[model samples]
Target: MAGPIVSRVSRVSGANGSSAAPIFVDVDTGVDDAMALAYLLASDDARIVGIASTAGNVPVDQVCANNLGLLALCGADVPVSRGSDRPLAAPLRTAEDTHGPEGLGYARLPSRDGTLTDYDAATAWVKAARDHPGELIGLVTGPLTNLALAMRIEPALPRLLRRLVVMGGAFDYRGNTTPVAEWNISVDPESGSEVFTVWSAAWGLDRPTHLPIVLGLNLTENIAMTPTILSRLAAAAGSATTPMSVLDDRGSRSAASNPLIRVLEDAMRFYFEFHFDQGEGYLAHLHDPLAAAVALDPDLVRYEQATIDVELTGTLTRGMTVADWRGHWGRQPNAHIGVGVDPEVFFDRFIARVGPYAATLG
Candidate 1:
């Protein structure tokens, strides 16, 4: 069942009508992360100012390589930077089983001469915020480590950006990583806690009308990608590929003519298999891409304001996200928790934006 598609400025302009929405991307380069980055690169309304590679789906080193390589593949000249290889307080753990080795599933990127910035991810994040103060839109589809670190050095970080969108947590929903915790937050609960804490504090100080919008598992799991959707995307890109099917072999690869479509098909095949093996279905939840979309267009999803907190002490619920509604906690609402979205509308946007972009590439 689909949800309502709220209407808002899908593409925002500068106050002086001079520039597109300046966005800063922080990602773990998961398969979905790749999809999200591609979506942003394709959006003419989105101006990607910088990218911060974080450690989640894979190590930060591989994340940076993936970011740089993806930018090169798309022929987009975007600056990529590296963040912490490990979590702020926990030992680093990766999701190679879910996203495959190197984070992009079975898809291989072409050799690229693109390089990372000399500064670290934390510095990159702070610098981007400082450079585009009160205008930068921060999108994090990975762990909160880099953002939390940046917030520490620059306390005004929460206010520095016009808006922030996060793709993590599970507001009383089934967790992808554990029985009660989401993968990104479970990877670094302390950092997740830090982000909410600092964001709430700064937001309280400034009292900005827009709160941080967070898309958690409760909502994201509904936006799933199936084989049929992939076929439509290929058709839109004018690529002929071996159609994906449940009857296909477990490790089948894509044969799309277009390079971008081929890579996405290959990557999504693994993701589909991962979910199917986990008893979900022959579909993959497009968590990150939805976050990327919501980052540019908040109207894609209906959000409810709430005070959200991360648990760090429970042995079994250390990374669990707890949302307080009805003023139970006596604190102001700190985040806008996404509660509804029309997957069809989102898929339509994805196909229309990415398919043509893919068609333009080799």
Candidate 2:
């Protein structure tokens, strides 16, 4: 029972002569989620307003701690709020195997000195959206529970925001969590379904109004973090001439002087091992980071209109994202699905921005 679709193009830049692009991110704070936060923090064009932590890769409390730790590492004091402890309609299930025990792989971040905000995630999300109105970009890299709760509190939440970008689902690619389901959506299918349905209604799917952009496995899988890219980042981090070196106030030119870069490198070692074991190459898919990039610049990836729905009940297909690519359902196109991405372009921007932040850690 959502309202009419609010048709408008996403504007990444500020008006005339304003500041950077205002962004509010929701995350489960896994390794990839850490990469996404680092990317946003390092981007001169993005001004992170707040972060809502939800349960997915880890428990809600752990996710909040991880987010706070990441923010502390980047020297960012953005408001962080704890979100839903469990899914709307399912028992909490975590992905410890994929993200490690603490959800950060081998990377261990220091405890944040700053305390979390008084406002819970749902309130924080609604308030940020209300304050920014059409200026805030919502980027979600976890389960849809927090968003669903916010939408429930404010039914007109979709129309009140500028745009929504979700990093979940699998349109035409194999799932990473299950044979037919993506981790985020599969973690909480009911919440995911609620979000998709309400969001689709908010932006007239049938008539073609504003549509939420979905960066699923089909597109994100194309961007991988290979050893070659890691080597380049390490080189950049160690160079005194590079911006990354500026993060080391101690004037240490060595990459080891940067705690952030070291932590990332350590985390990636575990991630690389995981991927190698799966025979998926010696690279980890940059899933959440790619979604974050698309949020900041939609043109980075090619999109196609599609009607997307979440499967709620099927013995083997529960939580599967059912994207109607063939028009069999004849449903309205709820999502602008990412079908292609320029890996070179994405990595160049990612390294330029995120590499520095990672070098700043410690």
Candidate 3:
């Protein structure tokens, strides 16, 4: 490891000279999840304390490999933990179609064996929460199996964390995984439902808990990444390379300089190809990255409080998220469901941070 990304990104202190905020992330290492991790690595305000690899985009072991390789590639020293390989009530489903074979699109990470911690993922979350108490911000860009299981082990988890940001659900928008389900939630509805039910109960506890900011497809799909954005990203990184186009050969690799930039570009190219095949133009919806940004700064998106719950009994609507926006449920709002966002603003921040960060690695 030449240099650590955490050490390279200057920490932005608070008015009183406090250090950067501590963040604990759980992910499936989807292409967008990789982008999300990169965003965190670039942010001066974020200090990733730990990472958990969950099964979703790929198998849990594959996700672990992706995470280890990415961290090793960036010279990051954060601890990595392995999580559940299947859902609570259903068999695991992988999204190879969306994120490619390795869950990183066409890009393959530099594998790092024995990178996983001896302690499992649920232990990692509990340790982080107990260690940081009210200072740890949790982010889940994959299925909620790990976090939910953690809650079962330590029921006071909701009250211990400062906040949480989940990238799941579809709200009123159409689902990408099914007619009524989003990918993450659809992957593990039992865990997702348990998380919401338990988190909502925390509102009335002795130590009131903050509702998680859940960024569903409703708000995330709005932040699309097209070839134009990629071109701007490359220029921002000072990588003088051929810009990608729709006419480009499918599964083509990136021509960026050696290391992180090339891997990221290749990964995004696969994402672009997938979206194009789905008739979504040559653009990718960066759902996980948007959630990552929101974790660092909550004001990035406009959110509405909702008593959220996942449908588990309905055969057709199972895994569907039902957000009670009008307080019909009379239950405490479990999540701050995102409803609005300015894509240009997010892109501006993303390009500004990620581009310069990649250039440093290059």
Candidate 4:
């Protein structure tokens, strides 16, 4: 079968009437990560400049493969760079149980055809930011290892980029990993701490000026991929017909056969089972996709300024995100944490944008 079909749409400017946002994505490339990539690729409002892979949902090697495959499926020309293989201070752990053995359920993407960039992830990050100073938006959907390493290499990385959006952490809610810690932050609390604290000092600006926008589980968990939405998406992809079933200029397999939709359906079987086991109504939270949405359109969710930090040393609560919603923490706020979302709006837009792309694939 062909990999997936992708069709180009007329480009649309963002809310500010500016051109498509230039974004650099750091991912672990799990199922939701694949969805996030699809959303970004299908949207005319996002221009993915680069992808940095890290260890979270799977090993860094697998993450790299997943990213490369997704890019090929979408016919995107973005660069993919390898990042940290493990956490900065914690032992490496992954969510294979949730994402399946390949980290994408049953979907086995083709092997990467080209060589990775000469620069490592840290260097790639610095170069991308330096090249597009004040124009790049960094979106991280995995552990913060790559971002932390980039910060170490370029002390001004955070300041160089226009904004940072993270899809991790759990504020005042039960965590998916440990009792208190979310998967991404728990995977590397030390790196998370570094990311939340480095930007302001790197920029030498007031805390509010460079605060990272954190999309924690508290907000993302609300944007679930319910059966209704999935069914609608599958119906759209299955029913739609398109030409161009052959390879394209990028040598990517044509998606006109709806291969991408079939792959997503296969992948979501495992995801749905996992969520069903968790009593979540066979719904997988669209965590990373929602974060991607917020990166391009900030108005999808409401945010609050807070002093956020990851717990490094709590016997039972290690890796928990300490979001100081109250003014108890004397320190200035360094993060704008997402506290709420409009699920109806999010799902409506998500299905509308992502479903058609799947349909166009062969």
Model 3: residue 48 alpha-carbon error in angstroms: 0.5
lDDT of each: 0.89, 0.82, 0.87, 0.79
Q: lDDT: which candidate is best? A: 1
Q: Once superposed on the true structure, which residue ranges of model 2 sit more than 4 Å away at CA?
A: 1-12, 15-19, 205-209, 239-255, 358-362
Question: How do these models rank on lDDT, best leading?
Answer: 1, 3, 2, 4
CA lDDT, candidate 3, residue 173? 80
lDDT by residue (tens digit), candidate 1, 129-234: 9998878999999999999999988998987888899999999798888899999999999999999988988878455455788899999999999999999999
Clashes of 1: 0
| Candidate 1 residue runs with Cα over 4 Å from true position | 1-12, 205-208
| Candidate 3 residue-pair clash tally | 0
- Candidate 2 residue-pair clash tally: 2
Tens digit per residue, CA lDDT, model 3, 1-362? 12111111112333344467889999999899999999999999889999999999999999999999998888888999999989888999998998999989999777674468999999999999998877888999999999999999999999788788999999988888889999999999999999998887766644323777889999999999988888888888988767789899988888877477788889999999999999999999999999999887877888776678999989799899998777776665567788889999999999999999988887
lDDT of 4 at 319: 92
Please list the Cα RMSD from the true structure of every candidate, rounded to 1 decimal place.
3.3, 5.8, 6.9, 9.2
Choose the strongest candidate by TM-score: 1
Give the candidate order by descending TM-score.
Answer: 1, 3, 2, 4
> Candidate 3: where is the Cα deviation over 4 Å?
1-19, 205-209
Estimated TM-score for each candidate:
0.95, 0.90, 0.93, 0.88
- Mind sharing the TM-score for model 2? 0.90
